[model samples]
Target: QQQVKQSPQSLIVQKGGISIINCAYENTAFDYFPWYQQFPGKGPALLIAIRPDVSEKKEGRFTISFNKSAKQFSLHIMDSQPGDSATYFCAASMRGGNTPLVFGKGTRLSVIA
Candidate 1:
């Protein structure tokens, strides 16, 4: 149970619109959930994260909704923009530990002008 799967290999949204991506995991042992955003030729950066202890987390325009019982999570972007276009990856891992994160195949988000 060490897999995280994401859908919509690509997404197209208009500027000032909302963008959503979903992810599912199979490992119950995983306690840390993080969504990363990556631009072209750059490493992914932690956009937002949520732990099993919390049902949801939000930072600015980014929000992460988590469901422990369902072992799933999703990222929501409010007011999406062309500048916000990037590859998003949902990941899971153990908390306060060095366990490698399991990443989704990735969803390429494009915001049209």
Candidate 2:
């Protein structure tokens, strides 16, 4: 069962613009939400994350806006640059559940100059 759903399999954004990727989950048990950024031939790395207790979390140019009641969340990349182009995956896990994170299919983002 796919617990998380992500939209826009691919995205193209011009430099200095914003790139948004959305995701939704039905499992209310999820308490931890994280977004991972993966470059070509490299493993996914933790980008930013948010818990149900907060509505948003920002780290530098990356921000995660979450809606706990709606069971949805999104990643917003500000001032998108070509170097930022990568495959982004949204994931969810229950804290201390000992269960691996459930990931979305992924969105390939291409930022043009």
Candidate 3:
């Protein structure tokens, strides 16, 4: 599979709450998993990621739980804050060669004050 699909085009959560988003991929050739956070008019920045060898990875308030068997992954934002409000994307890529990263359509997250 060469595509990663994300859901809930948008999300709204209260400050200090948890926000969750899911994604699925079809390509088994993909070896790298990365989640990116993007603000309006800015480039996406890597948030967290996990390879097929690992079940999960976390960075501060962000966590990425991956399922290799299911070909799925999710991003969990803990202690959501207004500053965390932004568009999140789940992406996949194979190392080496010219395999460009493939991204999901994106999920817009808004944390209300």
Top-down lDDT ranking: 2, 1, 3
Per-residue lDDT tens digits of candidate 1, residues 15-99?
A: 9999999999987889998999999999999999898889889999999999989989999999998999999999999756888
TM-scores across all candidates?
0.96, 0.96, 0.94
lDDT of 3 by residue, 13-86 (tens): 99999999999999888888889999989999988878889988888988889899999899999999999999
lDDT of 1 at 46: 90
Prediction RMSDs, each to the true structure: 0.9, 1.1, 1.2
Segments of candidate 1 deviating more than 4 angstroms? none
Candidate 2 residue-wise lDDT at 58: 97
lDDT of the candidates, in the order given: 0.93, 0.94, 0.91
Q: What lDDT tens digits, residue by residue, belong to model 2 across residues 1-113?
A: 44899988999999999999999999888898899999999999999989899999999999999998888999999999999999999999986866799999999999999
Comparison by TM-score, 2 against 3, better one: 2
lDDT of 1 at 84: 94
Question: Order of candidates by TM-score, top first?
Answer: 1, 2, 3
Error of 3 at 97 (Å): 5.9
